[model samples]
Target: MPTPVIDIDSLTKVYPRQIGQPARRSLDDLRLRIGENEIFGFLGQNGAGKTTTIKILCSLLRPTKGAASVCGHDVRTRAARSCIGYLPENPYFYEYLTPRETIDFYGRLQGLDKATRAREWDALSERLDLRGIGAQRIRGFSKGMRQRLGFAVALVGDPPVLILDEPMSGLDPLGRRMIRELILSLRAAGKTIFFSSHVLGDVEQICDRVGILVEGRLRTQGRIDELLNRRNEQVELVVSGLSAETADALARDALHARRSEAGLHLTTADAAAANAMARAALSEGGQIVEFTPIRESLEAYFVKEQAS
Candidate 1:
């Protein structure tokens, strides 16, 4: 079997509080296995322990229970620290240092020789749009610029695995697109990427697999196809003359049926049953309009999961 780049088993973390209150638990029985060369999206609402999990995986925070290994090395072991790269949601840079200087400084910390650092800076500066800003102090750079620099720092070590937290949070539309392309490029280069994002659209576009977390518990994890298969079946329709009564009845069947300018839209767990209902609507003098089946999208799945 191909070795898992990340093997986390029954991981748990809890914070102790004062005498009168209960101990706050951040994670409980969290388990996951991420393969090499996979762009895995770690998904969750805010305060779902995504950051805690990343911290533990990077060995920055010791787990309160269980264990995890990254790239065949114990996370607690110092040697394993060199096998991974981390990009925080808010990347901090020395406002006084230029982009090139920032990269060179981190490159040296990663044990790169002066000559090697020079070569890396040349390549990364151009790739990351730092050619102009490379010599300018970071204090004046935009949020997008700062994020790119952070990514460059993460790449300095040439680690096998990457852990990024909300990497696209502060970026613009174009900057977001740039980061997405960069991630796809990294995946093509056979690098493992583990990232958390509230941007479900991007996650759906770039990830090979995804894990959904809610209330610090893993609600679901799998490939896109598999997750869709396991979710409530939905069919979308563009019906012409959907009567108000029929629409109300369809909406009451634990299905989402809405009237749009194009037509009526219906989403349900049972496609056949929904079709039967549509027939019933027709019998009741409801005009059967355009019946286009709308497949459930990743965003819909996310919304359902969150609501659940």
Candidate 2:
């Protein structure tokens, strides 16, 4: 088996108890792995320890127990830090610097040659749609614009792995789409991405695998389809021309039923029942308008997990 780019094992973190306060455990015995070149999404409610886990992975906070590694190097070492690019939950920058200057500063810190920094800046600026505002002072940039710049800084080093916290927090719909495309593009270039977000839809759209953290504990983790498919599938049938009595009869085997101007909508968990409902509707001089089978959505599954 190919080695994982990120390996986290039995990780835990606890904040020290203060006067008149309890010692808060920010992470439990959590364990996870992200394979090379994969896009992994971390999800959770606010203060669910998602940020704490990310901070540990970035070496900003040390785990009270267990270990984490990036590119086979311990997260506490400089070697591991060099192999990963990190964007904190709220990235700050010099207010007087322009995008070009900002990226250049990061490039210099990474020990990139001037020529290499120039080339990377041009390429990243174009890829991130920052050409127009590349020379504008950071103080003048909007929140979304700043978020884009943060991505550029994180990517400037061309590291094999990226750790981003709430990368889409300040983005609009269009900005979100742009970030999605950029992330996919990075994956295509063989970069591993680990990011946290509250935008479940975006995570559902792109992540190859996802892990949900709840109250400092890992509630669940797995492939998106596998997790969602665990729930029973449901089918919906829409039929027209059915009398109220016929509709009621059809709904007998259905999980739910509703009336619409065009038809009676019936939903059943059993595919056989859905088919039977359609046949009964046709027999009653009704016209079948639509039949749809829908698996549980990620949001639905996430909400259920959160409740549990």
Candidate 3:
């Protein structure tokens, strides 16, 4: 396997308490590896220590035990920090700076040459749709605009990896779509993306793999389809024109059966049972309207693991 762009092993973090309160472990023996050029989604409920893990990886917070490395360099060292572009959940900027100036400032901090800075700025402005308001001051920018700028600043150095915290938070549908496209585009350019999000739909849509964290523990991590398919398979059959007797018989044997305005909905545990149900419906002079396998969704899997 190719070397992991982000590697974490036996990582733990504890927040010191004042007075009588006990120290809280924000992360506990967490282990995760993100491969090169892959889009990996980090998922968890509120206060599940998602932010703590990201902070540790970004060198914003030190782990009490264990180690984390980015691009083969220890996160605690300047070399590893230079390999990542980090966009915090709530990105702050100098109110007086324009989007242009903001990118320039970050580029300077990264010690990028003026020529390199200008080239990256132009490319980012066009890619992130920042051309219209690139000169607008930060104070008056809308949330979505600020988000676009945040992305531009993070990309100024063109780091090989991106670590974004809640990149889609507080955005309208359009804004969310824009960010989603940007993430996909980055992956296409062979940059590793590690991000956290509560929006399961976006995760399902864009992520190559996912890791679920619950209460500071790594609950599960794998390809989304593999995790979802580990559960038992089910099939749904929709039939119409079934006689009352046939409908009653189906309800007695099916996992679930219900009547709706469109048709009778029947759920079975396997394809064989579903085929039998369809044949039975047809023998009773019913018309088959739809037959669909009910695959487990990412949200269902996440919720089940979190609850466990």
User: Which predicted model would earn the best lDDT?
Assistant: 3
Provide the clash count, candidate 3.
0
Once model 2 is optimally superposed onto the true structure by TM-score, how far is the C-alpha of residue 190 displaced, in angstroms? 1.9
* RMSD of each candidate relative to the true structure: 4.5, 1.9, 1.9
Q: Write the per-residue lDDT of candidate 1 for residues 6-85, one digit (tens) a residue.
A: 99899999978879988889998999999989999999989999999999988889889999999989999867778888
After superposing candidate 2, which stretches have Cα over 4 Å from the reference?
A: 243-246, 283-285
In candidate 1, which residue pairs clash? Answer: 236-294
lDDT of 1: 0.85
Which 10-residue window of candidate 2 scores lowest in summed lDDT? Answer: 228-237
Q: Candidate 1 — which residues are off by over 4 angstroms? A: 18-22, 230-292
User: Model 2 clash pairs?
Assistant: none
Q: Candidate 3 residues 1-308, lDDT tens each? A: 48899999999999999799988988999999999999999999998889999999999999999999999999999999899999889688999998888888899899999998888789999988888888888898888888988899888788999999999999899999999999999999989999999989999999999999998999999999888984568999999998898899998899998889889999999888999999999999999999999988899988899878
Kindly report the root-mean-square deviation of model 3 from the true structure over all alpha carbons: 1.9
Worst 10 residues of 3 by lDDT: 224-233
Candidate 2, residue 146: the lDDT equals 84
List lDDT for all candidates, in order.
Answer: 0.85, 0.89, 0.92
Error of 2 at 152 (Å): 0.5
